[model samples]
Target: MGVKALLSKPLAAYVHKKDRSWIENPVEAQQAVFKSIVRKAQATRFGRDHGFSAISSHADFVQAVPVRDYEGLSSYFNRVKQGEKDVLWPGKPLYLAKTSGTTSGTKYIPITSDSISNHINGARNALLAYVHETGNSAFLDGKLIFLSGSPELEEIGGIKTGRLSGIANHHVPGYLRTNQLPSYQTNCIEDWETKLDQIIEETIDQNMTLISGIPPWVQMYFDKLMRQTGKPIKDIFPNFQLFVYGGVNFEPYRKKLFESIGKEVDSIELFPASEGFFAYQNQQQDKGLLLLLNDGIFYEFIPVEEYFKENPTRLTIGEVEPGVNYALVISSNAGLWSYSIGDTVKFTSIKPYKVVVSGRIKHFISAFGEHVIGEEVEKAMQRTMAKFPTVELIEFTVAPHVSQDKGASFHEWLVEFSREPQNLEAFTDELDQQLQKLNSYYYDLISGNILQRLKITGLPRGTFRDYMKSQGKLGGQNKVPRLSNDRKLADGLLGVAKL
Candidate 1:
């Protein structure tokens, strides 16, 4: 066995032992997690007002706390942002993760020390899970390039404020730092195009063994490396073994990403938000990520079909069944209480509580009653790409085209392509066919003549990169919304294309 593998055996064994019962008794594991969080936050005002002192069961906690979106808790968050002490958590937050918002402009999410620990430990445990299952840790001996945001953070109300990835950059363990690249200077450049240029200059010849990032940004890096070296990613980093990705669904990018690498490599998917790192892929055979019951986040699920109704039912982990989509609600160490982070997920397994993210709650296309979701669009695009092997997608978004002067109202696609298709008309036809097969409502709309066939608007290359650059969201943990119901983001992309 390799020396790296031999050294990791004990740590891997410990992770397995700790996680065994979580898989064996998911309900109990989650209940323990809830109870711990309640006790931890019980002294806070939110807990007091919500009767956490008298809370003995999940039912009582539910009765005491009302379901809340970010807007519902904005008042408390305002206070926290103003440097109020013990407004939510027991102490002041260490940082505020600034995430993109629609009309609100930006959202400042509190990040406590405990929350940071949750993120760091969650990533470490995920790695340990990989080691335990695959019995391979040779990647540890070489550089693991994390395509993260700048390390330089801005101060807001005496707390550091930045993207989650940038905040995390400061906490990479010293031992791991020895094998991490690019240099601190390159990572802190602030401009993504410049940062990418610096990263290429610094690490192109390094002994890179693992890489992790949001898929699109990482793809950009891969493309740059390929052009610079005139080689596939595998040729440039011969020891590369793993790709860890999150922030968006990987299915649409999987084929292109592998093509860039020129070979299949082990990959681990993660589900993390600004609030907390929630879940990670734990086993190779399981397609869904294992819901992290013991992480500092207590989870609740509101059935998506009922979420908009009056007095909607909220289910705890024990009450949730497999195969139903639920809007995820979380109460975390970060001081968020009964907060809906806007993501929807479907449980694939209840025994281990594994789930796949279905889509975002706000990001769906129902302009014509088709109610198409991000997953459906992504699956359709994936199928379309499979049929057209030469087409390389850079980025895309779908929006409703409701203008009457446009002949017929339909879904409009704004796509930036790295490689042009052999036949664009054939590609559109295949995409439409795939959509009809995936969503019955969409199929009905097409067949019933209620909506026109989807329109494809090919965008020039670098369109998305330019748009993100303009928005100052050009790096790690930031992602373009894949599907929006209206034309707001679509118009923005069009403007950038014009530029």
Candidate 2:
């Protein structure tokens, strides 16, 4: 948090020329570089058969750390692939992301080598405070695009590497990245359909300033880079600027990806995972917040009033401070120690702390703020099925309840039966008017219905996450909770299951 306090920040004059006295240096030198990344992510979360032990507040690190998913890193990633180091991390495991777990179907998450040099030092301190708050790194000189999940590297119980976007695109620094696309091929460990059709024809005509991933694969790589260049994404990148993106919650498809890139998209918000790259975005993009990448994630927020009291409340990275609303905890180096990557944040100001990504400590529906995650209801159901092409679909989910006669609470849309349109309640009322033209506070609280007010069900004969993958518990890390404000398992599977 420096660049001379963001060069007097108005987003640092809109994007460059920072030095606000290195963001008022000294929060004890940012906790001595977050206690040396919490003693190297607590030596990869107490590996070599559990060891390191140091506790302080935030309810004594959630009563000495106890909250892990990714099924406790797939039971210590099958003992770190037999080349064993006991469990968490000690010897190997440096970079490996290759994700796909909503039930560990395709895995590997590690991310060590000091969390890949803490994700390139948190992407060069969030691009030097986003070029000192948008003064302009030319919004990051063209050709950055990420939209990942198909780079290479494969393995977990077998242990391979590369894949956090091909090890950050084969270790970034090829003079900071840009040979248009195709180049991370250490024999390109192939997967996700062998380089997504030439990575969608090498990002169609190149030149893409900072666009990052996740939005139905960046609108299927911008609709196949706009029908193979018939053009109209501002003429294939008329100097496109910022557009980062996180796993979800893109404020209801931000006006359809800013009206399909016609303009205004200088975006941000990352909070990376696959075990690291902790938090980002604070170049005054949306007015400063979400900071702690603390030199490779050693953070630990946890507070939404002690997350339902099984005992919670843990704020580190120098005792948090701002407006509170926590829950993150990392420890990193791919060993995940004080682990609890569920997410749920909120902090607005405190010297250089800043933050506010509030949701998903377990995917959405915390009543109304409808995080509806899993990539914002997969971009509000692909912008409401791209305005219906015979309403074809093969899957869906979005439960959340509370309507005992409009006591108020919304979002229902269960779906799964493919085709539609025999006026099924006017095709479910134009898919709830395309999620209320993509959010007008969810279109005045679901048309004054006070949030989705029930009734969309469907699923004809399948879809309770395909019965949680016919009971294999749907693979590894397990998913299918794209927001469930209520509806207790879709009301006991509509009282009989079968659909």
Clash-forming residue pairs, model 1: none
Report model 1's TM-score to 2 decimal places. 0.95
Query: In model 1, what is the error at residue 15, expressed in angstroms?
Result: 0.8
The regions of model 2 sitting more than 4 angstroms off are 1-116, 120-171, 175-178, 181-212, 227-275, 278-307, 310-328, 332-341, 344-359, 366-453, 456-499
lDDT of 2 by residue, 347-367 (tens): 677666666565566655546
User: After aligning candidate 2 to the native by TM-score, how far in Å is the CA of 347 from where it should be?
Assistant: 30
Candidate-wise lDDT, in order: 0.87, 0.58
Please state the error at residue 89 of candidate 1 in Å.
Answer: 1.4
**Candidate number with greatest lDDT:** 1
Each prediction's number of clashing residue pairs? 0, 39
TM-score versus the correct structure, for each prediction: 0.95, 0.31
By summed lDDT, the worst window of 10 consecutive residues in model 2 runs over: 471-480
